[model samples]
Target: MIDVYLFSGFLGSGKTTLLKHMIGQVKAQGLKPAVFMNELGQTNFDSDSVDDGVPLKELLDGCICCSGSEKSEAQIQTLLAEETFDVLMIETTGAAHPVEALDAIFSPLFAERLNFKGIITVADSKRWLSRDELSPQIRSLFLEQIRHADLILANKMDLLTEGEQAKTIFELQSLNPAAQIIQTVHSKVPFKQLEKTTAKKSDDVVKAPVAKLNLDTRVLRFEAGVKRERFEEWLRTLPDTVYRIKGYVPLEGDKYPHAFQYAYGMAQWLPEYMKMQPQIVVIGEGLEGVELP
Candidate 1:
């Protein structure tokens, strides 16, 4: 049976970055890995970020919540059947519910071949502290992610001071004392400690009610660089209904275009300086009619 670790967190909580770190550790430990990404809507960061050697499978139709368990599990089934590996890492969207996704893996087809090591929920320290300002919908998801995890990895600890980091760990431990709270920046940590969860926590997680967040999800697939300034303006001119965005953009004539990623009201600029055409992705709420140059 292949050991499986479910990496769960809300958008911008650094789920993708953590995957990179975990895979590197797996390689160092001489373990081969197969990764499955449910990169729904407009995100384009998964494929390019991984090395050429590790096999990858993607399910990009929509959020896992919308896809349901059976279909999502089928994608995992397909990937496992196609390639054999020593371990599997599932990086779920920050918006997705981890328990629901984990439960899907319970299907008989996958259960026999897989052993769930533990669920690792990577928490966003600074942002989570300021979650009250966020929409109730986003806040609820983050809390549920923490509530359901068997192990909680508080990433981006570098963003905080020594005192703040201590407080954050204390607060996190108070949130779920049963969970092993490991802190690090960019999800860098020794895997031997992170992957083990022999604690006897109860099976039930107290779920906070989720509000009807007007999720403005879209698929932005564009190949253009209509002046970075113009595109930035286009991004700002979008409707208030737009909540989040993620995708890749091949800058005109530039090796790899720019990648647009937004989470919890924060945006990041990921420029690809390599000599590859930017075939990227973009997903947001109010970007229905917006087009890239």
Candidate 2:
């Protein structure tokens, strides 16, 4: 039986970071793993950053919990039929609802062959307390992502004060009393805590919540290599309305393409060898007429 793990969290909550770490751990154990990354727009960065030789599939243009469900189910069936992997890791888009994701995975087609392992949610401590500033719908999305998690990682603890950390934990507990919470910096959670024997079904999660976020995505493509320093400077000064910025950027004088991720005013880059056109996908609410340098 294939053990399956679902990694769910709000955008910029470090789901991709934790998923990469978990994939590395699984590889270290000599176990084969397959990844299904659910991305909101056509552009994908996390899939490219995955270094494992394991088969990776991207469910793009929608979240797996909603519009992408059919495609996601199909991908799972295809993997089960054509590939061999000891485990499967699914990284859902930040806006994805756990209930809908569970419903899609636990469908009759996947019932017998797959063993649901764990639902891990990563929470940004700073973002946690700033929910009130976001639109009501987005705030609900954040809370819903935490509601059904088996393990909730209170990440980015370094940015919080002692009093803020206490309140963050208290709020998280109030939202998800059943989840096991672990505080960490940079979403670094113990690998052993991720493996599990039991799983929860659609009924186990709350009823499927409708997504009301008016998210807009802008895709920018650059055919030529861009100067790393100039790009970095522009990324550092992105508008506050931009919640997520991800893409494959070809840097000048570099043989390999660079993968970039920008969230909450922080930018990260790593050498990525994925053979894809260079483009960036910026996602956020109220992004109309937004220009990027």
Candidate 3:
């Protein structure tokens, strides 16, 4: 049976960083790894991160837990039929509930071929500390992500002070004491150690009480190149409800479009060598009819 691992976390919690590390480690060990990624927007910006040779399947425009579950099963079925790999790594959307994602994977058709490894959750230490600032629904989702993991990585430890770090670990431990919690800067952890961990088995998997979040996404296409300064100014005008933004932007005078990411009021721009589609996907609450500059 092939090993299957689920990577769960909130928006901007470093799941992709951990995924890259795992892919490298798996390759180094002479093992093949396949990736299944789910995105909230029609365009998947993170799909570029996966290597060209790796087998990749993406479910876009929905979360696997709800509207995307059927699509997810079909994608997995296609992957199994088309690819030969030792392990399959599934990276769910940030808003996904871990239990629901697992349920989607436990399909009868492919159940015998997969050895369910476990859920590895990446929690932003700073986000947990300030979770109260979020809406009750979002906060509950964040906690549920932590509560269901077999192994939890308290990521972004560098951003927390000594006391805050203590509290972050303490609070996470209080929520799920059975899981091993590790402090990581960029979701870094020992791959060999993770391989030895198995998920806790229970006869009954309680469904999470929280309903699906009323989150929505907006895709912004740039018809003309814009000044970098002006783009940053527009980012500042975004309200706090905008949880995550990622895509490529064509900045004036640059040879290639730059990859842009925004989360928790911070924006990052990375220069790209190849020109990509000049569009940005904004994910947040009540984003319908929202205007972008």
TM-score of each: 0.83, 0.89, 0.96
Off by over 4 Å in 2: 196-204, 223-239, 250-257, 271-276
RMSD of 3: 1.3
Best by TM-score: 3
User: lDDT tens digits, residues 85-124, model 3?
Assistant: 9989999999999998986679998989999989999998
The Cα RMSD in angstroms, rounded to one decimal, for candidate 2 relative to the true structure is: 2.5
**Shift of residue 133 alpha carbon in model 2, Å:** 1.0
Q: lDDT at 282 for candidate 2?
A: 91
Per-residue lDDT of model 2, residues 6-25, tens digit only: 88888899988898788888
The C-alpha lDDT values of all candidates are 0.71, 0.82, 0.89
Over 117-206, each residue of candidate 1 has an lDDT whose tens digit, in order, gives 878888988776676766667677778888777888888788788988888889888877878888878777777875576523335655
Off by over 4 Å in 1: 198-213, 221-223, 226-244, 250-253, 264-293
Single out the weakest 10-residue window by summed lDDT for candidate 3.
199-208
Better of 2 and 3 by lDDT: 3
Residue 197's lDDT in candidate 3: 69
